[model samples]
Target: MSRFHLGLIINPLAGLGGPAGFKGSDGVAQQALALGIEPKAAARTRTALECLLPIKQGLHFLTFPGPMGADLLAEMGFAHQVLGQVHEGPSSAADTREAVEALQQAGVALILFAGGDGTARDICSAVREGQPVLGIPAGVKIQSGVYAINPRAAGELTRRLIEGGLVRLASGEVRDIDEAALREGKVTARWYGELTVPEEGGYLQQVKQGGVESEELVLADLAAWLESNWESDVRYVFGPGSTLHGLAENLGLQTTLLGVDVIENGEVIAHDVSEAQLFELVDGHPARLLVTAIGGQGHIIGRGNQQISPRVLRAIGLGNLRVVATKRKLATLEGRPLLVDSGDVQLDDAFPDVVRVWAGYKEELLYPVGK
Candidate 1:
């Protein structure tokens, strides 16, 4: 197989991960170390480097400046060239924007970066088309298509992709949350654009979305499917969305419509739990996450339900998660892998072979979500 040329961007402040109560990882860099949060961008970068470590010499890397991209690669002992201006370290999100331009100018096969919703937004703004890309979880709230589940999985997939393994990259919509509104328990997601998603072995992680659905029948079907599937040992964590609220209505439980709800064996255990709380609940039981796409724009995680934190996803097992969507809603996916933008690097990496979305009774569409 021929060597692959990849472009890397590191958004230092993109998601920070502070809002989820998991501590921030990319806040100005300096404060992160002091607080022991560890720079998330660096961690994400390291994940990529470590995965590429054994094959470093065979790979060509183009990256942003220190603290932005290059330095992390250097620290990981990889040989790579710096792209554009070496600004010591990217001081702000603007640096990421600048890196996007440089990567496009250099002409790369794929553009890889790490960050959450804000970082995805920055990436979307930088490049609208050209260059397939993926992400390594590094931000606070990841909600985009440019990222992989985790760093190691990214490396594994990179190997397969470069080695001529049957692989394809698809476009997934870019979704973001209203940060100000988020603080007030209001969740909002808007379409930023689309990015390339790599598909390996017909597996794709669940993608989160945000939009308005006027039809009531689709909601009704989604609710019916969820109700039929509830069983013992299946702890359901309902994410915020009208579709999810519909499920809650079927169960005769009050749902916040925009908050995380926990359903265990037909009982409402908790309502609107936080990331920590969600994980705590997950610790004791087997979980099967139930969430819906944002609508128009498709996303499964990292949009509004920050409460279902990365830790929670990890505890629940990515394979155990269920993305419930009506046929009308699934139509919006357009044969793309569902997006899972969880900010935790490990959880992002832990996603399963085929994310079994509740398509219909005994009928599942095997989508390619990851490499």
Candidate 2:
């Protein structure tokens, strides 16, 4: 197989600028030191880089000169040629743009970056269209398809792609949530577009989950069908997303915008249910877990909604799990397969082969997961 020149960049501050409540890591270095938290972002970055060490030399790699990308690469014991240099107190969007330019000049076959939507946007401008790229989840809010499900997944995908294995290729959604509104208990996501990526199959990036993250319902007919078929005996474990809430909204019941809630029949049985409570509710009554994709992250679980772990998914059964999203939302999933990271690797591997997404009417789309 021909060796590919892989570019690496890290917008260390993209998601750090998010709300204080979200634990944005831009100031985490300071916070950790103050609280004597021992390790900091540097430690976490090293941990993430360790995942990539196994296959670093197998593929030709290019990166910024210093902390922009190389510093961490160096900490990982990467002894190789460096591309550009920009070591300062912190990394920013300007540095991201410069690094992209440098990598573009170097003619990298792919640019695997680590950041959120802002970083994705910078890379988008660099590509102008599509470039073979991937993301290592590092930022606070990762609402972009560029990121792999997690750091370890990023390294594994790199290994598979570098080996020239037959892999699935598709465009992933580049969705970003406005950080400001998220602090106000409102989730406002804007669909940027799509990106071509190598699908390492089982790896799932965080995506805007559920049938609805958007407030407006374009799928009125499908919503009506779900409403008509609504079962009273069933407890609906509504995952985080605006789309699932639409099912509740259609019935004139209030749904929590950012938290998970439980619904039975046509009434809101539980609101803002905790993970333990969720398990209890599921145990007592049969429940169907419904969720949407992260706008950019493409994650089905273990991102913000840690409530639905392998135990939860198992209790509900994969057959009973309902993933709902609009055609536009599904369009965001074009290049990437439906991702399921249930925290437990064994169970995550046993995830449903095909996710039944309610695209429209009786018309549904079957998305292959771990394909």
Candidate 3:
């Protein structure tokens, strides 16, 4: 029997900016590092690769050297060949593109990469139109549809492919946000291109929907309800998204549209805070997490809001979470359960099977939650 040849790429600095409150990890990696932000891309890639260990004997990996791919593979004792060398310093976008080109030439069956949307754009630029690729969700700006819901899901999909299970291919859009605009409190996402990815509706995340919600009255009503229910002693941690931003506007509070903010007693205490800052503020305090699902993705946790880290969630507690989304946005999911990929497997597993979503004025819908 022939071994499955898999190509691997890891963007070592992919997610450093997320927890550091840099919005996106494009050109500010060094600054984030200066702030002592630890990189998690390699760790996340390891989680994905761990799922393939059972079939290690039947697999052969082709990847770039060091932190790009070979380091983690070597640590895991996978049978892999190093394909190229990364530049001496921190790996740049050029390194990712060069690695993709080399992997294409190697005729590998699939290219599994760990990065955010920017890395997806790099892969799209260097590969042939139909070349197969899969993304492990390990980057800050994961607005692209190419990534698996989480690292474990990426490996599960790869395992099925290697075992010759019936899998279908589909085109996923490669989208990215302008980090400059994102930092300026403006979101401008443009479609770069598309990549052929292994399709399993349950495994792959849907493209993030970008636009204004059509149901203006519904949002206003939801915001009103939240305002009426505000507790003076409870700190409100607002997660990012247009839906929550609308809620903030209702309260006449300036908030970061793409970053987490903390409010207490009807005042914005912190704006665009990092995970560490958030943990410090909410720990041992009465806090309610006010978050909304990604429009089309149905992810109430861990899509783009990394500031709401596991410790932050522990501080806020699951019972204090208030999910707000318009019914129209919920319909885009087509009855799929909301997803939570908080990076802590046990924490994600502890989430209840169902959650209550505040849909409108004094209205709540019992929605299902999934890992």
Residue 219 of candidate 1: its Cα lDDT? 52
What is the TM-score of candidate 2? 0.47
Give me the overall lDDT of model 1: 0.66
User: What is the clash tally of candidate 2?
Assistant: 32
Worst 10 residues of 2 by lDDT: 202-211
Worst 10 residues of 3 by lDDT: 201-210
- Rank the models by TM-score, top first: 3, 1, 2
Question: Which of candidates 1 and 2 reaches a greater lDDT?
Answer: 1
**What would the per-residue lDDT of candidate 3 be over residues 159-228, giving only the tens digit for each residue?**
8665533245677899999999999999999999999887553222322353454556777787777778
Q: Of the candidates numbered 2 and 3, which has the greater lDDT value? A: 3
Better of 1 and 3 by lDDT: 3
Using lDDT as the measure, which candidate wins? 3
Over 226-336, each residue of candidate 2 has an lDDT whose tens digit, in order, gives 778888799988887777767667667798988899888877888998888888889756788888777544567777688886777778887687667665665565445
Off by over 4 Å in 3: 201-371
The parts of candidate 1 lying over 4 Å away from their true place are 19-36, 86-90, 202-371
| Highest TM-score scorer | 3
* RMSD vs true structure, all candidates: 20.0, 19.4, 21.7
Please provide TM-scores, in order, for all candidate models, with all chains considered together: 0.50, 0.47, 0.55
lDDT of 1 by residue, 1-371 (tens): 22346788777654454743533333434554455654456776676667667777757778867677777778777667887674554366678788888877765656777777677777778884634667777666656666677777877776555443334545767887776666567777788888766656432232223344334655556556666767886678888998778767866888788889888777888988888888888886878888777665667777887787777776787657777666456556554445667787666545543344554433333333432
RMSD of 2: 19.4
